[model samples]
Target: METAELEPQVLANRLGVEFYLVRQNNTIGCVITIAALEAHFWLESRASDARILKTFRNGYGRICAIAERKWLARPAATRLELTPADFARR
Candidate 1:
């Protein structure tokens, strides 16, 4: 797959979840779990949905980068869930 600039968008779903676009080719469902946010992005466990989105937005750049890398590694995956381990330093 071509390394196109994939812009992330807010997919309307239940609380504690969001999505990122995979360009014109396909839509990649990226799930940033609440546990990941709490562990990696300084998000409170009881943060509201708005707060959750805000935290996700604040770390959007890095999160998207990691998601993109994972997507590249497994191009055929329609959905990818990101965890705190994904953000851990190697």
Candidate 2:
């Protein structure tokens, strides 16, 4: 799959699994595969969220590295269809 231009749903399909990145201290670290991407939205803790706390200490740099790598690997995914809420943008 071409990394870029793939939405979360499409990306999951390409990767053959649902994945979500962890954001801690404003840094995105590693990814965790959940029952579904939205699953993490409802759960307080996520599976595979390890390495995020760096032995329960700090993992900011690690998360930023992973996020940068993954995001750069993907293509530009534009907003295909804006919603009513999006129209609020001023």
> Considering every candidate listed, which one attains the maximal lDDT?
1
lDDT of 2 at 48: 39
lDDT of each: 0.76, 0.31
Q: Candidate 1: which pairs clash?
A: none
The C-alpha local distance difference test score for the whole of candidate 1 amounts to 0.76
- Model 1 scores worst on lDDT over the 10 consecutive residues at 1-10
User: Model 1, which residues run further than 4 Å from truth?
Assistant: 1-15
Q: Per-prediction TM-score, please? A: 0.79, 0.25
Q: Write the per-residue lDDT of candidate 1 for residues 1-90, one digit (tens) a residue.
A: 334324343345533466665556677878887888899999887777778878888998898899999998998888899888999999
